[model samples]
Target: MRATPDNGLKIRAQLEREGINVPSLSERTPSANSKSDRKKVIMGAVIFVLENAADALKFVPIPNPDAIPNLLLKWLKVYDTVGGNDDGLKELGNDIRKAYATVLQPLELSEQIPPEVVRLIGGFHSDLEEQINEIELLKSQHLAKRTILAADITKRISGVRTCINNALNSVSTQATILTLLREIEASSQLTLERLPRAAAEHTYVKSKSACRPSTRVKIQKSLLNHLKEAKNRFVWLRGSPEIGKTAISRSIASTLEKEGTLAASFFWDKSRTGVGLDSLEWFPSTLARQLAIFNGDFKASLVKRLRRPDSELILNLLPEEQMKTLVIEPMNRLRGIFSASTQRFGIILDGLDECGDPDALKSLMNLVLLLDGLPSAFVILTWIRLHQTRLLTQSG
Candidate 1:
């Protein structure tokens, strides 16, 4: 039963009369003894049957539901005969069969196929048909041309898979970045909420007063000079009541703040009788909170500390322990970022003598010594009574 051009044309005409439109096969008939031509004929038959099976599913009643599975089995037999030696073609065939079985065949059997499902199947079928036509055309060409076309098709399939993988990875990376940003934001908000502060203690409080211009110039100049050139970290501004020590401290704070080196300031007024401004209970946490607001790097380091399991214990610790944990630890973490800089941060404590507790005042004097050993340069200025100032200067 050798195929001939006249036989192909007669078969096409008969099918056309039956209202079927198969591809013309007159120019594709195989030679009687050519194995390659025989393989081409088998491939064409497989493609034709697959197309008929796909078309049969389009009808509402589906001409013969049982026959469609039989057509698929026959398609696999023909595919194995021609494509078993070509791994790429064999894999493509398996994928097509799986898609049909998994998504279309079951839906068709249920008699509830949606229009979108039909469109999906139609698009998939068209793409497979185009690839099969290309393979058939390549098979008819010279061996070199067939090899080139086969390699090109393999490359295209691999590239499509790679693109899909890259898109998925990009979406995952974006989601990770967004999650990290949200966590950082939440941590920052919590840090601000947990720390206690006295709003009236800041140097910018409207009720506080700075030194009058041209007054106390000699003492102010000497203090500023010592801050700039002295190796000691602590400076004591000592005077009796009504001698303007508080005013001079306020003036120094304003100057350092304007120079962008003021880390924090706290003013204690004994006149605010019932207020806790005369105690050290909220002192360390308040300064730490202000430092966090002053610098971005310090804020990030402080947030890391707040995430620790023991962080909640910081607030309950004594003033000295709180100072070390809340303030010194975060400043130590900034060593790498601050090492190259010579700029000194100024921390002002106005009216330290006004603190009502003797034990707390002594503890604070010891804490000032601890600030001297910190990694970053810091200048601490305190205003106290002349009698109390001698104890710290003598200890230093």
Candidate 2:
């Protein structure tokens, strides 16, 4: 309970002297005629308290209206001095004592509801008070509900948000699966568009592994035949340091690709001076990247898939059949722009002698060749004439 402005303080002091909790309000207060009667008694005692303060200041010099602020301070000083056990103050105290009995008369003498209940009942009072204040405005003006068009627009916005969430989730799931697929095998390469979210495509490239054929004519002819026979193939070209096998293979691949007959090609250029021996997965990845330039969604999807660490691609490299089952199967299942066109997929693997591990190279080439069911696949293996030339020649 708090003291009311000025008058209530004096009433409170008087009530306290009588061992009555004056400033506190609770359900225990006795009622007189009604609750209103009890409030009137309290207010009356408060007014009488103000009268006591007026009498206490009778001896103080009155100041001009202009000096009221200073005069009020002086009046308070005198009141404080006379506050403790003064006869006049006690008389003033008696006045409230007499008033308390009357003030408390309106409180009914029955079992009381706890004070906590009273506080809880007031929980919504602030909001009710604000609404009551706005009653005048509500009476003067009509309030309107949300318009039908506004409601419909809100519903549509919510629906669109849900749809966007669903789309993102699906794309994320696809990316996770594709990346896992990339880790497990290297038979086919996943290509993403070079835009935002570049992990949608699994990032795996076929190892450039092949035994080079002896002649450029044979390389060209073998590549052509592989293109007709398989969709994914590895062809290696072998020759001495200055041999023009790479140039010839590139010319053939580029021309065929332009004619929409070849899906991809990797020609290792000795003069160009970089990592050579491109084939299988690497070739198709380049092709897919180039193709993705025209498709933004494809680029974003590929990027998203490439970023996933748990991609299947990392796991598919164990056995040849596993590589086929995981990598090649998924590649064959891809329904994209590349498959929509009738172009054949070709890989030109150049420079077998330049590769560090020839046996591993041979295994990779063999795996690509053994990937069955892709009729339009082809690989052209290029290498320098060496001790391994007989081996390649015998295999051919």
Candidate 3:
């Protein structure tokens, strides 16, 4: 039966009792020939039933309540417009509607339904519509047999009931799976928050200086090309003191930041001595924090690593170990997700020679070399004074 204004008002009142406010159907005129207006009435009725008849329709568990109206409207549109008053099509539509209502009536209450169930229901409706169309075509060609068509209609209605029952049966299993996923996400978020980080080491610090607009153009271009096309991950830029390596590093970081590919940057300054800037103690954790911020997939993998039972000792490990634990492992997990077309992520380490601890500087170089075996898309740029040239030579 077509939904009338009085029926809509009753449905609205019922929904109001359930703490929902739906606009009255009287707000829009209903015309069966007008597709838009007819669909609106169907949508309004479906939404009203879902909101008002929560207890009665508890069998249909819609996890996302907002999605049901559109889904149900799609099924209903098969019978939405009945043209030329074909008696067989009209009777078939009535039988399908009755069968649908009957199927929903006997289902047990549930709290969730998977997308597979929804697709199954949609498939049943499509198959039923196709059968009806085939029968119509046969009738037009004067080849239709009434008994055969009746048997097909009965079988189609049985299939609809079976589809609904199957969907209801699978709800409990799907709900369990969904609950487990949510718990894992919550746990991951907590572990990631517990990861230690240093904020001051970021390249955007006020004391940091980038190259002048007109200067270092050639160096910046070469550095960018190396980042994009070079197979080797580590690029050591060794130069004499006061040659503006830090400035060039900062400028490269800025350019990468604008392009959304800068993973992290750390600059060691001897002038900022007492603030722990000369040590590599916080370096790995700082980069881990920034890498987590850069990409969600990396963050998830890092959180998984941090959730391990022995992960608390990650910060206490040697700098190279810390780099492997926090950076390399998580980046390796992203190999399956990245493609050749994906932009390379830039990492800048400036002035490691200024680090006062020789042991820490040695460990940093080891860590840099270790990073060379990482994904080809990860670019590691290290800047050091000419005096530290022997460290790279010795390590090689």
Per-candidate TM equals 0.52, 0.32, 0.54
Candidate 1 deviant stretches above 4 angstroms: 1-183, 204-207, 273-276, 393-396
Candidate 1 global lDDT: 0.62
Q: Model 2 off-target regions past 4 Å?
A: 1-241, 268-327, 334-343, 370-386, 389-396
lDDT of 1 by residue, 221-248 (tens): 8887777653857777677888777788
Q: Which is the winner by lDDT between candidate 1 and candidate 3?
A: 3
lDDT winner: 3
Give the winner by lDDT: 1 or 2: 1
Clashing pairs in 3: none
Rank the models by lDDT, top first.
3, 1, 2
Candidate 2 lDDT for residue 362: 60
lDDT of 3 by residue, 93-145 (tens): 33323333333332324455457555644554455455455545534443445
Deviation in Å, model 1, residue 275 alpha carbon? 5.1
Give one clash count per candidate, in the order shown: 0, 70, 0
CA-lDDT, candidates in order? 0.62, 0.39, 0.63
